[model samples]
Target: MKNIRDSHFKLHTTSPSYPILASTELGILHAKDHGEWHSINAFNLSQKLRDFIKNNTEIFEIDDVFFKSGLYFSDPNKVWIKCNLLTGKELREILCDKYGIYLSRYTKKHILINFHFGVTEECLDTLISALSQIEKNTLSRNFSLNENELSEYFVIPYPPGVPFIFPGQKISKNDINNIKKHQDEKNILIYIKEVI
Candidate 1:
């Protein structure tokens, strides 16, 4: 039984022994000593951020921006904010360039903010202030391609790293519709020959 368990563990594990040992030790320390405290703090901070954003929708100028986890259970470690007017790339660039705060782009229209154990109220305040100062900038115009016209362009969704339409590949009406739907949802970036 012991040998079987050992063989199974080795087969399932990918990391080398030394690093895995160190990581396991750290995980144990965190879980045993600081898990509850960190959980509570992260939960409160995430809630505060959600509340701030919700209350200041005028500042954001977008309704239903934040992605809700559920009514009863929510992940307090990360929050996803939807970008209606600006793409996620644009929003991330603006936040990094202007506010010196970097955010993860979850999709073309969604930016992810992560809450760490060390996150403070002041950090949240700075984020709120930066978000309030953001104004919509004009997006560059791209030639719209219809279902029949999609063969010339390459459409890729960044977050999931999937290509919807590859250049020179024939796309069916359904595939074209899916691409258009994703684009309309601000969930993809379409690349054209001229633009590239």
Candidate 2:
């Protein structure tokens, strides 16, 4: 089980976003109520995550059911995997019986290195300081504004609701690839953070 603790996550969700998702800095658990997505520090985990996603595409793509594998992390030991069918026991049975996946009735948590979505140390400080004065639910959009500039901090729907670029973070080539992967998805909204 991953240790859940209060964290100083860099970005905060504003009015345009859901309050529940505001302070993503906090550690995450894989509880059903929290949905299948878990928050991991996405640092070294991004490559691992991409590999896991590629490897398990068949497992996840069953019956029109595919899930994003990039969510939970309080303890990196707890690898996050999501199958669209959480309510079904078949998933557990198949994983355990056929693929030798460990089975657990309880949701797992992951403890990961705190990453400011690739933000550098100095920028993280700026975000934290700015976050202190900002209204609880108010968000300052920054970096990029539209789908064209996806590398800049854009908030997507929860399942994969992160990867926003903080002030000091430069857009990596991988960031461009991630955005390009979903370029056709009209629903992905990328907001430009209004830096202080």
Candidate 3:
């Protein structure tokens, strides 16, 4: 199974005004809870998250599910995010000055790099290419991780509930079955890969 820890990711919160999203996309809002009309499929969910991070000023409250963060991180209206302890100051500055968004008051304790990359091959490439282009002088690279190490855990998209996993941790058999059941019933897909 994929090392759940290696798959841990933080999402970028963006403003609803980002220009990257088309009027049609902006109008294509899904209820916080995916209904019968649309399901929180893995591909689309990651894409929306990537778009929000690359183009808008958004914030998220931490969510806890799957015994990951426990219930402490779950907040429907709020998103809890973790940044590299070292990059906290700079990230705070970028979000505030560049995006004009305020971070939550909660303290960040880890260096978790939330690579909110999409599950599709194309989106994954886009994310990697963008990461390569970031100039070290212009941006802090504290959150950077070895590219080769990224495949250790696959990014899972479980919406309404934050994506959950940690490297080296085994996915409970029950969770696996539940995920599969959700896929069969709601057309939702949870990405998984063995932890190298």
Which one is best on TM-score? 1
TM-score of 2: 0.21
Q: Please give the TM-score that candidate 1 achieves against the real structure.
A: 0.49
Off by over 4 Å in 1: 1-27, 59-74, 135-196
What residue runs in model 3 are displaced by over 4 Å at the alpha carbon?
1-65, 68-81, 85-89, 110-196
Instruction: State the lDDT at 152 in candidate 2.
Output: 33
lDDT of 3 by residue, 1-196 (tens): 2432332332244544334444434455543334332333443544454454445321221222322364455322222343322244555555556544444444442111232222344543553343333222222212222322432344354454344544544666555565556556653333334332
Best by lDDT: 1
Q: Rate the local accuracy (lDDT) of all candidates.
A: 0.66, 0.37, 0.38
Tell me the lDDT of candidate 1: 0.66
lDDT of 1 by residue, 78-179 (tens): 788776556678778888998999876557666888888778888888888777777322222353656555477666654575666777776678876786
lDDT per residue as tens, model 2, 118-178? 4344533443333232212122222243333433343342236454555445667665555
Q: In angstroms, how far off is 44's CA in candidate 3?
A: 4.3
Better of 2 and 3 by TM-score: 3
Which candidate order results from sorting by TM-score in descending order? 1, 3, 2
